[model samples]
Target: MLVYFRLLSESFRFAMNALRNNKLRTLLSLLGVTIGIFSIIAVLAAVDSLDKKITKDLSSLDKNTIYLMKMSFGPSEIPQWKREQFPNVKYDEYLYLKGAMTNTDQMGYQIFTKSESLKYGSNTVTSVNVVPVSHEFIDIQGLEFDEGRFYTESEANSAAPVVVIGNEIAKSLFEDSEPIGKKIRMYGQRFTVIGVLKKQGSGMFGNDDSSAFIPVNFVRQQFGDNNKGLVNVIIFKPEKGVDMDAYKAEISQKLRAFRGVKSGEIDNFFINVFSGFTDFIDGIISQMNVVGWIISGFSLLVGGFGIANIMFVSVKERTNLIGIQKSLGAKNRFILFQFLFEAIILSVIGGIIGLLLVWIIAMILTKALDFEFVLGMGNILLGTGLAAIIGLISGILPAISAAKLDPVEAIRTGM
Candidate 1:
């Protein structure tokens, strides 16, 4: 064990000396490995970060949440003209589903509206996302309050002029002052600020920090049921551990019967399950991973070739030294292991530099953008493993050639 350790130490010293003496060559050799590590690791980090954000955004909602509407979340067989001809989902339909649907935990009615401005005395917030939803939305969306509370069911049913503002809107309009019981103007009507939403950063749906929710019935009362500007949807969150297929079937059948659609005819509305939408997103992410790996694999290939080239050159330069070591009875395996370890060390050094670059940029971008960029431990381990494997493969043949050198012939040639 001691003899082997001494041999390893001698090999380490030799490898360091080579690096010190051939600075330019060593740098040129490591450049490919560095770029390759950077390329592969960067791609992995980006995809992983995106996946994390999506998960975080959807964390509060049950994966089985259903959207009952006319528009499909994914590609559909229905033609554009046919889908256009379908009637809009109504408030009555929402009430019917809310009452009739079984195996359901919660259901809420909501209307999609265009961006509108809100006014509080002199301070005005422009282009605010105005979500008009029923009182049930509070439970369905799992909304938490920073101050005050979501509108009561009676307030929604009566179409009362009460509003819940997002954290950003609250800060902009009121600053340090109390916002509850204050009045704001929107749609040419005075609405009392009854609630304030907790600060949620930018998300896939929209930033809760800059959005507001009002009673869905309030919009219905103002525009009537036939308002062309509003798109109505009923959100359903099913009970956990229920058979999903049967649950969706039950929803479709109930709507079909209520609409008087013939058994042979296709249902006019879309049943967009939240889980299905996420599965579609997952498929896209998988494709991105494949494409990224293919592109980065080319960089790694070039990097491997560069390392191999350097190892061959090193063997040639130290031919006389290798010959003397063999004459002193150094084992072939020792020579092979020495070269292999040197190659691995150099490759690992390059990989570390690449990882460091990723970490620094990840921090900078996270600060600059609303989205967070993460370089997880799994990716770091993967990068290191790839570097070591490249080194072992690249160094093998060169190490073998050095180990097999004829000592007498090598010494004479050196002279």
Candidate 2:
């Protein structure tokens, strides 16, 4: 063990002396390693941030709840025939489905309009998404109220002109004043704010705290005709211990019966288990990570090539030095180990610098935005591993060339 440590220390001292003698060349060689490591670290940090946001967004939905919507959740596009078969589901139908299902815990309907500019006094917030939904939506989406109560079913039934504002919306408009009971105008209609929601922050879809919630029935009455009660989607949770597969089958059977679809006829609706949506999100994030690595890998390749080129130059410059070492009883293995260690050290230093750079960037991002950096230990280990592998592989030819130099001929030559 003492002998190994001495050898390692000697090799390190020799490597440092070599670097000091040719500072410019050493810096240029390390530039490649620096850039390569930087690419990997930056890409990883950004990708990790995006993944965190996506996961947080998906978590808004309960995994046990089933989502019934017009669209499918994945890359498999729904066929035109499927679209043709499934007509718009009406609000009355939602009531019937709710009544028919024995094992459902809760259900909600949602209809959304394109974002609009909202005005309170002189402050106007533009492109704020408005979701007209029933009170059940609050519970389904796991919302918390900051002030006042959500619109009740009776208020929705009566088409009562009440509104609930998100924290951001309230902040933008009323600032410090209580938003509750204040009147705000959206799309030229004045609605009284009944509640202000606690801040939920941003997600993959959009900012959850930048929208307004109103009664689904009231929204339908004002913006929709006979289709006012027609729902865009329905969400429901299953009873405890109920097998989702069996429950799904029963729901399918019931939907077919309710929609009056005959045997062999395709049903006109789409259903999705929450797991499917989460899986789709995971798939997207995985694909993004793969793409990021591929791009960063190209940079690493360039860096590796730089290292190899520099090592080749080093071999030429130190041919006489290698010859002297060989003449002094140094073995070819020792020469190879020395050169390899130098290259590995260069890469590792670059990797550490790159990691620090990425961490600073991530911290800046966290401060400028509401997101948190998610630099898992796995990413750190992976970056370090990649650097070591590149150094070893790129150093091989140079190490071998140095090891194979002819002592007499190399010492006789000026170079």
Candidate 3:
């Protein structure tokens, strides 16, 4: 054990000496490994961060939550023309489902409409996302409030001129003043702000921070109940441990009956499950992982070749020293380990530099974009382990050659 430790120590010193003596050559040789590590680690970090953010953004809602709408969230066999001709989900249907659906934990109705400008006195914010939803939306989506509260059921039913603003909208429109109870102008009318959502950072879909929520009834009043452009959806959260397939069947049958659809006709509306959407996201992440590995694998191959070249050169340069050590009763294993450790040290150092660069860039991106970029322990360990493996693979042949060299022949050749 002590001898092995001494061998490692001596190898480390030799590796340092190589770096010190041939700085430019060493750097050039390690460049491929550095870039390879950087490419792989950067891609992995980005994918991980994206996955985490998506999960965090959707964490508040149950995965079993379902959206019933004219459009499908995932790819569908239905053509666009047929989907377009399909009637929009109406308030009556939402009411019917809300009251009639069994095995349901909660349900809400919402409308997706065009972006609208909001005015608070002389201050104006343009192109803000307008989400007109029922009071039940708060419970269904599990929205958190920074101040005040969501509209009451009565308020939503009555189409009251009250609004809930997101954090960015509140900050932009009201500045330092308390936003609650402040009236904002939209749809050519004054609406009082009743709630402010917590600051949710940028997301994959869109930032919720610059959005405003109002009563769906208000939207119905303005756009009328049958407005073709006003897309409506009914969201449902199923009870925990319930059979999703059975629940979906129940929903389909009820809606088909409610819509007076006859047998053998396809259902007009689509039922999109949140879990299906997450599965789509997972597929995308997997594709990204495959692409990252393929691209980075080339770099690693080049890096391996570079390390092998350097190891061969190292063997040639230290032939005399190796011969002397063997003449002094040093074993074959000692000579092999000496070169092997030097190669591993070189690769690991390059990998460390690459990781450091990734960390710095992650910090910069997190601050600049206001999105958290996580570099987890697992990824770090994976990177280091890959580097070590690359080192070992690249060093093996050279180490063996060095170990097998005849002492007298090696000494004579070096002289």
- Highest-scoring model, TM-score: 3
In model 3, the worst 10-residue window by lDDT is: 199-208
Which runs in model 2 stand beyond 4 Å of their true positions? 10-28, 80-85, 225-231, 367-370
Q: What local distance difference test score does each model get?
A: 0.88, 0.78, 0.91
Over the full model, what C-alpha lDDT does candidate 2 score relative to the true structure?
Answer: 0.78
What does candidate 3's lDDT look like per residue over 294-352, in tens digits?
99999989998888899999999989988999999999999999889989988888788
Best by lDDT: 3
TM-score of each: 0.94, 0.89, 0.95
Which residue pairs of candidate 2 clash? 86-268
Model 1, CA-based lDDT: 0.88
lDDT of 2 by residue, 52-131 (tens): 77777877677888877655666546576666445665577678888888788888877756788889999998888888
Model 1 bad stretches (over 4 Å): 7-11, 79-81, 223-229
Instruction: Point out the higher-scoring one by TM-score: 1 or 2.
Output: 1
List per-candidate RMSD values in Å.
2.0, 2.8, 1.7
lDDT of 1 by residue, 121-181 (tens): 8999999999999998989988989999999999999999999999999999998999999
